[model samples]
Target: MSRRTPYFFLLPAIVFLAWFMVVPALQIFYYSFLNYSVFSASTFVGMENYRRLFADVNFWWTLLNSFLFILVTPVLMFLSLVLALCVRNLQRGTKLFRTFYFLPVITPIVIAGIIWRWIFAEDTGIANYFLSLLSIPNVHWLTEYPTTIISIMLVTIWRGAGYYMMIFLAGLALIPKEVEEASLIDGATIFQQTFHILIPLLKPTLIFIFVISSTAAIKIFTEIYIMIPGAPMANKALVSFLYQQAFERFDLGYGSAVGVVLFLITLSFSYVNIKLIEQRG
Candidate 1:
């Protein structure tokens, strides 16, 4: 293909990205250097925004949350792989199973938020109700600090793992039958075959899942927003905290600064991930 052909094909995306993404991102960067409120005039403030962000206790927690979210990827990956294997091995109604697995992925986030909110409701929720079944007292899943984060993580894993599983299912299905047969002929156990053969071959899929899930975790918002309003979980994610500062607290300037920092951190993360993957490849 000619060099111009690729650009021609990409021209529309490039135009849309420049207008919507690049321009707005650059504007955020510009605003990060200003003391601009949502309603008031923005004054040039140099790097004061960044400085304040470093000193803000809540911002530090939010940053820590971002790292924790990234760290959750391995668990997510393991869950997805197990799910993909189970679904792949099903003999009857494979399509039905696939659809069931993908249902959460395609479900509206609003609906997920509503469902999880009900499930973890402080007093009337099913989770606590079930805990009460085991003679355990009702614990406020969404209100308690440490438990709140864990609850959100649990929800995150439940809502997201299936989507990654579908991706993994596709990758698993792509493996040549002969490869598995050869491994079987060599008397490899299921674990050995999967670990020594399948996983190495599935590296590309794993990498895709890792990067995408890590980014998704880092940008988590709506789940926390809908489920843990006015509670500790509100501060569980940097993006959510950024939203609080920007919209709720009406510190648009500071919020913009937070956004800028999040953008930088996320970009740096993706860049490093790509570089490491390239080196390994």
Candidate 2:
């Protein structure tokens, strides 16, 4: 085949990327430097929007919340790996278990958010009812600061764990059966084999999950938007803050500045993950 064949095949994808992702991202970056709003004429402000963004107390708080939200990454990685291991050795009905686990992934985020919102409601909610049965005091899951954050994190984990579990399952499937058999013959315990052999081999998948889950955690908006429509002080995420600025308040330039900052933060995280993987390799 001619060398041009590969380029020909990639042309459509390249064009799509340039037209959609690259153009839109460039526009956002340009807007970040302006004093643009829906109601006002655009004017070049040369980083004034970014300066104001950095100085704003609410912006700082939302950024802090975004970082705090990333705490869910470890929990998600651990639980997904554990679930993958449990299902990995199953001899029968594995498909059924996988389907059930992935049900949450396929469920629409809006629906999940609404359902969780009601579940965590202070009054006439199933969560409080269960707690009442256990003789525990009613706790406001979504009305308070840390509790609201935790509740959103729980919903995120529930929705994301199955997807990561599938990735882990694929990684596990790639392990050589001969290596496992040799370890078994050496009288290595299941724990020893998993910790020493399986986990080390699964490093790439772990890194991927870490990067993806961390990015998703940072960009979380729809869940918070749906769960707390007005985004009360306790539940405001960075993206929701951006949404409020751009759409609600018509501060388009400021919102784009927030978007740029978020992009940089997520890019840094992904870069760090890639570096760690490279060093491990």
Output the number of the lDDT-best candidate.
2
Against the true structure, what is each candidate's TM-score? Answer: 0.90, 0.94
- lDDT string, candidate 1, 32-58, tens digits: 888877688889989898898888888
The residue pairs in collision within model 1 are none
Residue ranges of candidate 1 with Cα displaced over 4 Å: 1-13, 232-234
The collision pairs in model 2 are: none
Model 1 TM-score?
Answer: 0.90
Provide the lowest-lDDT 10-residue window in model 1.
227-236
Every candidate's lDDT = 0.84, 0.90
Q: How many Å off is the CA of 191 in candidate 2?
A: 1.1
Give the per-residue lDDT of model 2 (tens digit) for 59-95: 9888889888899999999999999999988899889
RMSD of 1: 2.7
In candidate 1, how many Å is residue 243 off?
A: 1.3
